[model samples]
Target: MSGKSSLKDDIYAAVLDDIIEGIYKQNEIITEKQLIAKYGVSKSPIRDALIELCKEGVLISHPRYGYEVVRINEREIRDVVDFRILIETGCFRVAAPTFTKEDIEELKNFTLNECWWNGKDELPALKHWENNMRFHLKLISYSGNDYCYRMVENSTGLLTRAYAQRFWDQRDNRAWNIDIEGHLCIIRCMEEGRFDLAEQELKKDIASFLDIICPNYARAVDL
Candidate 1:
């Protein structure tokens, strides 16, 4: 990427991050002129970033309103989570048998560090969310399925931001404050070569979040 393009990508990422972090709420209008002034960039980068956001379903453009943040729905949230569970659990189960002791230890360390950083007041929620995403993506990367890995990576950016924004908007709870003990449980099950239990735990973890975000679907899935 050229220097200008790289800067544009950075601008795009920063704007998306702010939107996903709920700094820009639903139906809020944003303009390229404002962004151009805020980021001290030209219209090219600002326009490109807005277009990218539009493509990701994060923003909508109208003739009268420039661009507005998209409102999330229960159906979209549930669908994303369900898709994540299917792809992630499948990846984990397939890769669990191949994980080395070193691999497991690394995962354990990452989880612990996340727990530690989560308790620190200086750590921003966005950083915690990013770390949480990295931890899961790293695990799935081990599956050796390049295509699946890329798909998850791409879908996760948009889905995670949407889920996180809605979650924080509805509740004051911190994302990092989640019960990561479930992660330890998953790691232990994988270490013991108990793939079935690991899969079950994974489903439970995903289901718990689904219940919070989309209770009706969670109940339906349980039934």
Candidate 2:
């Protein structure tokens, strides 16, 4: 990437992290100058990053107040998980029929390779999020439906927002342990050609996750 483009991406990640970490609350104003100083960069990259974030619905631009963080609501949180369930379960129904031992091995390797799912928060918060994304995206892709894959990618940001809020608010070992176990359970169900069982486990997993992340999700996303 060009230097300016790379800088823009860096600033974008940093700003997103700050917002996710509750460094800035919902509707909090963020100035270009503040970001420039914080990132030690020029206006061009900061502006680019903020504009992209605005487009992503993570932030909104205000003529009077620089930029404001998004306040995600309970409905939006439910919608993300509900939508994910719809897409993912459908994928599992189809994908499991063709699921192979090698596929299971590959996915197992992928999620467990750099993850801290054994005990607790041994994994960094961001790494845990990334690991979840990898598993979900791969699960959908195995269905051989490109559209399902893309839809999950597009809609997953809401969960990311919610997950980040919980992580920033509290890092619980139990949560991580359960999350990893849920993934493993689904994989095993798929391996056994028990697609129905896989779907049930997935629903249970999502419900458990939503319980911890929602209602309180606005605490991190809103003002």
Candidate 3:
């Protein structure tokens, strides 16, 4: 990437980080002037970053007012969760038998608390979410299908941002409740050459996301 392009990406990530970290709340207006001042950049890169965010559905553009952070609803969250189940479980079924001992070991590492925060100083919730995403993406990658990997990556990104936006104040509580033990069960099933059981555990892991987001809501899949 060119220096200018790299700068734009950096600006984009910084703004998105603010949004996911709850520095920018849902439906809040963000202006180019504010970002330019914060990043100490010219208007060109700032506008480019805002446009990219708008295209990703993270922000909506207003003619003269500025950009507004978009709020994710329960229905949309369910749709993303359902899509995750479809893709993640399907990929695991194809990829589980192909996993080697090394892959299994790496997956097990994600279950460790320190693996998510070895050197990073990010918020606990963001670190936890990053670990969850890495685990799932790494597992799906064994499918040897780039298309499937990209799909899971994008959907998981949406879910992560949604979780932060929805429960910013309760992030720590929700992050701690994630099903890390479920990941262990999946890994064990794979280690035992029980791909069938592993696939089932994968489905449950994806559905468990709903419990974290909406404690009282009924999941579409019966655990």
Candidate 4:
């Protein structure tokens, strides 16, 4: 890649992470100068990165000054959880019966407490969000539905923003171990071939997360 392209990619990755980590609040303005300094790149890279984010709806463009971070409100939050609930609950219905013990174990591999923290033992919201995504995607993929996995994966941008917006400090204050426990419950139910219980646990876990992140977000996920 050209230097400019390389810089743009780096800036994009860094800024995207910040956006999804909720480090930059909604409607916040970020200037190229700030990013140029932050990423130690030229103005061109920063401009390109902002433009790219705007394309992804992660940022809104401003003429010459800077870009504005879009707000991910409770409605958006509700949509994400409800989406997960709908897909995941259905996934368990189909995937649970076919799941072997090995499948459950595979899903469990990522839910370890070690997955929640960074090398410094700090619980970063972005890292945890990634882990959460992996868990959900792994479960869906194991369900043997190609379309389902792709559908959920396509929501990564929006989902990451929603997660970062609320979960930035949640892991710091709350115990992510509880989240692992919830996943374990779902896995156990699936392994036991109790699809009903697995579905219930999956819904409850999504609802619980919604309650924590955005209580104003409608908690009901209609089947």
**Candidate number that wins on TM-score, 3 or 4:** 3
| Pairs in steric clash, model 2 | 26-222, 26-223
The sequence of per-residue lDDT tens digits that candidate 4 reaches over residues 18-134 is: 776567876789888888777776788788888888998888888877899887777776777778789878876886667777877767765664344344245454665566677
Which pairs of residues collide in candidate 1? none
Please provide, for model 1 over 163-213, each residue's C-alpha lDDT reduced to its tens digit, 9 standing for 90 to 100. 666656755453443456677788898788787997889777766666555
Residue 4, model 1, lDDT: 79
Model 4 alpha-carbon drift over 4 Å, by segment: 21-23, 113-122, 167-178, 219-223
TM per candidate = 0.83, 0.80, 0.85, 0.79
Which run of 10 residues does model 2 get worst, by summed lDDT? 169-178
Which residue pairs in candidate 3 have backbone atoms (N, alpha carbon, C) closer than 3 angstroms, thus clashing?
none
Q: List ranges where model 3 is wrong by over 4 Å.
A: 1-3, 109-123, 170-176, 217-223
Best by lDDT: 3
Question: lDDT of all predictions, in order shown?
Answer: 0.76, 0.76, 0.80, 0.73
- C-alpha positional error of residue 207 in candidate 4 after TM-score superposition, expressed in Å: 2.7
Candidate with the larger lDDT of 2 and 3: 3
Question: Which model, 2 or 4, shows the larger lDDT?
Answer: 2
